[model samples]
Target: MFKGSFVALVTPMLASGEIDKDSLQNLVEWHIESGSHGLVAVGTTGESATLPMDEHIEVVKLIVDYAQGRIPVIAGNGANATDEAIFLSQEMAKFAIDGFLSVVPYYNKPQQRGMIAHFEAIASATDLPLLLYNVPSRTVADLKTESVAQLAKHANIVGLKDATGDLNRLAETKAVVDNNFALFSGDDGSGCDYLCQGGHGVISVTANIVPQTMSEMCDAALANDFALAKKLDEKLVGLHKELFVEPNPVMPKWALYKMGKIKDPCLRLPMVLPELNSQKLIEQRLSQLGLIHP
Candidate 1:
């Protein structure tokens, strides 16, 4: 179903910034063991923006290989240009990825017609089922529920990743979209509410650190166990907020490094470390939760 606790997996790097395959594979195996439903590789968490084309594809290919049937790999293939997105999605499709997570075009800020054409072009060029990603916070172009409804009618466009953190439109999209198309929340903090409000699940950066927590939360919500879901949600609230204290993946990488799950906690250019004050709090919570050695 491609729903529920898809980790926006970070591309773990060595101190010198080489792709840390050993750590990446270990993380994949860990997610499967931890009950993650799927894995999203080369995403914002994976630092896709900084990765070179070849390296990006290589990361996707490697994750597909290492996962070795353990889980589905939803490769992030977003770009400002439809043609570029097409080429990238096609390249990524050569691997064992189960689907593509393409974002709404950014920077150039295309209009609604352009948005329709962009996704339609990619869907035309490749057969990969797509989960449309709309994070206007980063992309700057919001896809209205109307455009999403239009796109969902396409044969290959399968679902949406709603990062706007607005439930009103999510309810609208879920109400109007074709029968089989689905919706997923990209925001982690209220992801439980989203799922219960008819979203299929989440593409969660929070899952990178709390894989089991996310998976369990989604399962609880799906089973209509709000009481249990609330308890797990409480366990993850500080984690969900702190991970985004600055830029995403910065604090997430930091938390994982302290857990000995990763090597150096470095992000690529244009992304910097969080403030020193916040790092202590981040580590403090991790210690309080016993995620790190005290």
Candidate 2:
């Protein structure tokens, strides 16, 4: 059901730190037109952690409704607390969401047994298809392949978003996981390699800014057109280096706001505005790509 390029959407906000609804809807439509296969709301790219519950669920509902089945809406239902994840999971499931992108429990590192229990409880609670998100850089506790393959036994646990960046682990997961189970790259930089190693797609942050190019790269990788994929990857070469010069969405939001595609691009506390240097880098690249006005 969920396959191909899914953009990890940026949550557009006003200067006063409120989400801009019209801008958000427009962004969703833009992704659909640019050939993104689906959309992920309120993930790391959206700064999901900083959003209040009402705003979070509201964003999920808005994206689900906006997508209107043209593409799947995968809600980011991740929390360090299993209870918090459960609450958000149930809330999002109330909408017409096609799937839940559950990050490996962040902050409070859980053991393998705890990880299994957490996902099992979520599966028991809702019918939304589950996409296990393993971005160890943010979540700290990596969801290992042994455990992920074991969890894939559940009918609802459908796929994985691997950010581990270790090609060997991806190979292991592909080797052990069920033939029907799917794998998608979570790291934008090495996404082509992951696809070559049997990854079906990517949950991409880069796609938010350059969906056409990202979609082409994923299509090439899926079709085993390594030559074309490499060609497309060159267009995105700086994206991997610059987007993280500060942190995600900070740079991405700047890119979009510079393009006047978004309004204020306010980021929440603890994760403040980007450094002037980082923002300048973003501006320079956006200009170079012709994505921003001078």
Candidate 3:
């Protein structure tokens, strides 16, 4: 049921590397005002890997409580371990998040059957809707087309956020699954085509920076207006690529800082701020888009 320009929101943090509640509140307001379809709080862009369990749940709770049904909030519940993911989902469910975005198990690189087992276990544990996240680049283990179809059988396993960017899989997955299964494009560059190819929506990193344009593009695509969707997506091409020029949330956070949406783009340990060259490229793109002063 979740669709359209759901931002992989960055967790706003202080220069001291602490969660900034005021800035986070302001960001929720800005996104709602800017017309983001929904919010994916504590996803990859939200630095989920770096956050402690308490902090992660706190962030999700804060957003859910603040949003107050203004928009849907999908809590990031992916973990390397199946039990950890299930426990996290169970804990967060108490807060009443709209759904959970569970990524493929990273580092371990399980086989398709193992992947199926992992998701099925999580599905059995919670009645909440679960969106499978398959980013082979980050997770190593690719959740194959057949594997996704297998997971789709479970009642709670609702949809997928596919970063594979293979449009063929859009048609492939749809061919196998029931009509109710939603397919959200996680690859921003291919999002317009994904929709035109019959995908449901996008779970976008670019939307964190340009929520209105992304939301409008998804609206156009969903309306079957490829002309309008392509035109809107064209403007975002620079953002789609540049935001990932460094590891996520680095450049995205920087872009938000430049837009004055957040105070400091401070990241946690192991993910420092972007370098000078990367910063210059990001700034040039932001200026080109008129998101920042030239």
* TM-score of each model, in listed order: 0.98, 0.97, 0.98
List model 2 lDDT by residue over 182-291, tens digit each.
78898888888888777889999889899988898889988989889888888788977798888787888888887888987688887778888988888888888888
Full-model lDDT for every candidate: 0.88, 0.87, 0.91
Model 3: how far residue 200 lies from native, Å: 0.8
Q: Which 10 consecutive residues of model 1 have the lowest summed lDDT?
A: 174-183
Higher-ranked by TM-score: 1 or 3: 3
Q: How much is 121 displaced in model 2, in angstroms?
A: 0.8
For model 1, the local distance difference test gives: 0.88
Off by more than 4 A, model 1: none
For model 2, the local distance difference test gives: 0.87
**Model 1: colliding residue pairs:** none
Listing every candidate in turn, what is its Cα RMSD in Å to the true structure after a full C-alpha superposition? 1.0, 1.1, 0.9
Model 3 is weakest, by summed lDDT over 10 consecutive residues, at 1-10
lDDT of 1 at 230: 82
Q: Model 2: which residue pairs collide?
A: none
